[model samples]
Target: MKTDQSLRTVIVTRYILPLREGGSLPALTEADDDFKYVLKFRGAGHGVKMLISELIGGELARFLGLKIPELVFANLDENFGRTEADEEIQDLLKASTGLNLAMHFLSGAINFDPSVMKVDAETASKIVWLDTFLTNIDRTFRNTNMLIWNRELWLIDFGASLYFHHSWDGWEEKAKTPFLMIKDHVLLDKATELRKIDLEFKSKITPEILSSIINLIPDDWLHWRDTELSPEEIRTVYFEFLKIRLENSEIFVKAAEDARL
Candidate 1:
């Protein structure tokens, strides 16, 4: 019942383009001033609910002190469906500097790999605290959706978040300990300064960002009537958890600042 009943017949096709020397999907786009935005089309596995989750979850995480990429919803016409990025969008991206982590273009500007990122125990602890608060289980060792832009860490790809909606009774228990935040298994623990900064600036998050997060929930994604939980209810729960985490971020931040290494 929560599905966006409005988009029942909309065919959201944004054609896939191949990047040279790369296997990932990076849509070709033109420039707009100086910002490089990804050209994303609605794909088969990308339902409205999942898109909502990506936007809401992403915005929420950004508000909670994580670095996130800017997002936009491009409205496509019949002619624009899955077509290459226009001359403008492409130019914008080409002129831009910094890392790009689009589904199509997952490249690090430098030769940085997670294996040697030097993520320490304390930074890992803060990451675990953030992930657990968000109920995000996708940032594991192999699938840590991260990128380094301008030597700063940015989190991306949050479509798999909110797994507590599934049939897991003891999911809350996972939040009790901060162990999942490991040095090497997930984040490059070497991001100690970033972690300290993240803690220092946690209070600057605005309320509009939080409200935009709650409002972006696509109606279809709420899963209102399922025997399990609905996305709406799940998001409400997440909002509360996030508020608490933001208020208590100092606890984890202090831990990182006080770490040995």
Candidate 2:
């Protein structure tokens, strides 16, 4: 996770606008550091589990040398958005008055359209490998949850990654499952070097990296309200799921390779 101390405690200073484009209605907000961010609320949709996915998937991508906006642990106060005219947004802010996830907004970034912007084979293959490993099924051509900034590809919106977390059951089995969704991936055709990229990435997801990423999820986000598992147990579940995913990578790697054919 991007645990730079400045990111440790960013208080949301002002609400700028509601990004209604997303189902969760993530907001454009300014922080104490005077920087604008796209804030993902903990109280929205899938709630904290979404944030957890964002953290792990994004940090894992960064570790593997993919470009992503800096993610910060944003703090929101109870009355932060009370003055907003929209009642729905007001209630959302009130409910999300604690820890949340935010990405440094990429000003002037354009949505990535493959027709307009071409990606190299290696980069496309790595992204295919990353999404397949992360189980992110949202990167189809329709959505293409990727952006272009300064002529570089920057990944965004990992909330859809780690889909298995939605149920919080059968996690171990889910980890080793084949990610058959790669066939619909926007870059799958361009990802010609899937096997090579898999070899380069499989060993990079070490236990230490897994532990470091899982440990970054906060206790509040770790709470599974429907389950009796404590935060520590929940953290262990995350670590174990990812550890097994790393060990059993061949399943998804082959799935991606076959999908390209």
Candidate 3:
């Protein structure tokens, strides 16, 4: 499980500002390591589940050779953010006093604008294939959720992926179903190598790799709610779900290619 270096831990030093573009209320915060991060709070409206999705989705994208910011576990102490003038921000800080999810902040990155720049077929194909595997639904034109960092495309904001876990029911059916929403994906038309990329990517994300990534999910997040399943049981459910989905990737791979053509 690569338990030795699961994720680098950082302590939140200060909340620099709030980023309202995302519904999860991620903030620009400085960590004790002296690096800035876009911190996703467990106290946010989407709750800890969103953080879980963010962790898994970001790691999966990186595993597939996609460009994504480095994710970290940011620890928030209750004493932090006590002097913030905004009551809302103060409340949020108080509630998220434990481990939160964050990614290295790209200081000068700009939001991706398709009309201004274009992506190549293989890069687009890999992205489409990855999103389809995770059932990410937020990559449409309205909100690309992509950024241009150092003139390269970088993926971000994966809290919108893995939607099936919201209800935790019928995951097997959802895993096997075609993610028809790929039609709205910004890269759909440019993803010309889904067939070839599918073969390449499926070989990369094996059960061992999946287990290592799944092991990164924090126990507190898994048992956040009063669900009947223990944290370990919940983790097993996610493992099984992804295993089924990866085994059935061809369904969505074809669905995406069909949508593209």
Candidate 4:
């Protein structure tokens, strides 16, 4: 885990255009740092939890040494939305007048196609393990949220990964349950060695590392919802959930192995 650098905060200087690819309507934004990012708003229809999921999933991928774009906090000023002619985008910008999540945009990167690009067994296993561990239901052949940048595969758009957060009523039980969706993962066939990858990742992802990553989320994003749980308490829930998943990863690993057969 690279703990040397934390997520940087950049003010939104310009909202260039909308990507129109995903339902949330992420935009091509130029931040104060002069870098363009795919900005995910806090007030989008998907809500703040989606941002939380993106941050957690992307950071976890980074921790596992996978290729993921750098995530930053994009600060939106009140007048930032005035220039957008689209009413829907104007409304979206108006609602998201504060901190939002931004993924550093990779220019000229092509969508990953399995037939054209080959991934090694170990890399495939690690990616499959990650998607399975997080219960990410988005990375199938039809909608593989992956990119080929600089001749390497990069994981992107994790807002749909942690579906358990949408309804936390049975989160504990669901955390331990098998992620049956691994069978549809784009990299499942190439993940021939699950047990070895699981064991290696288990040792690397300690409780401390998880806590540190979870702590990176801003307080507003964590506590803004009308829930009784304080920001710290909510973070604790995530930590515990992840720890339990890591401890019982064998259940998920076996499921992935079975899916491979």
Stretches off by above 4 angstroms in model 1 are 1-35, 39-42, 82-112, 120-123, 166-185, 188-212, 218-261
lDDT of 2 by residue, 1-261 (tens): 333323356999999999998989999999999999999999899999899999998888888999999999999998788789998998899889899999999999999998889999999999999999889988989999899999999999889988887787789899999999889999999999987887888767777778788888888887776788988888888889877887898999899889888
Ranking by lDDT: 3, 4, 2, 1
- What residue runs in model 2 are displaced by over 4 Å at the alpha carbon? 1-7
The top-ranked prediction according to lDDT is: 3
* lDDT value, residue 102 of candidate 3: 97
| Per-prediction TM-score | 0.52, 0.96, 0.97, 0.96
Q: Which residue pairs of candidate 4 clash?
A: none
- Whole-model lDDT, candidate 4? 0.90
lDDT of 1 by residue, 129-205 (tens): 45544545567566677776677666766665555544335444432323233332354344445455455446554
lDDT of 3 by residue, 1-261 (tens): 443227899999989999988887789999999999999999998788899899999998888889999999999998999899999989999999999999999999999999989999999999999899898999999999999999999999889889898887788898899999999999898999998998898888888888889889998798746468988888888888899998998899989988888
| Runs in model 3 lying further than 4 Å from the true structure | 1-5
Prediction 1 global C-alpha lDDT: 0.47
lDDT of 2 at 223: 72
Q: Which ten residues in a row have the lowest lDDT in candidate 2?
A: 1-10
Give each model's whole-structure lDDT: 0.47, 0.89, 0.91, 0.90
Candidates, ranked, TM-score: 3, 4, 2, 1
* Better lDDT candidate (3, 4): 3
Tell me how far the alpha carbon of residue 173 in candidate 1 is from the true structure, in angstroms, after superposition.
9.8
Candidate 4: stretches off by over 4 Å: 1-5, 224-226
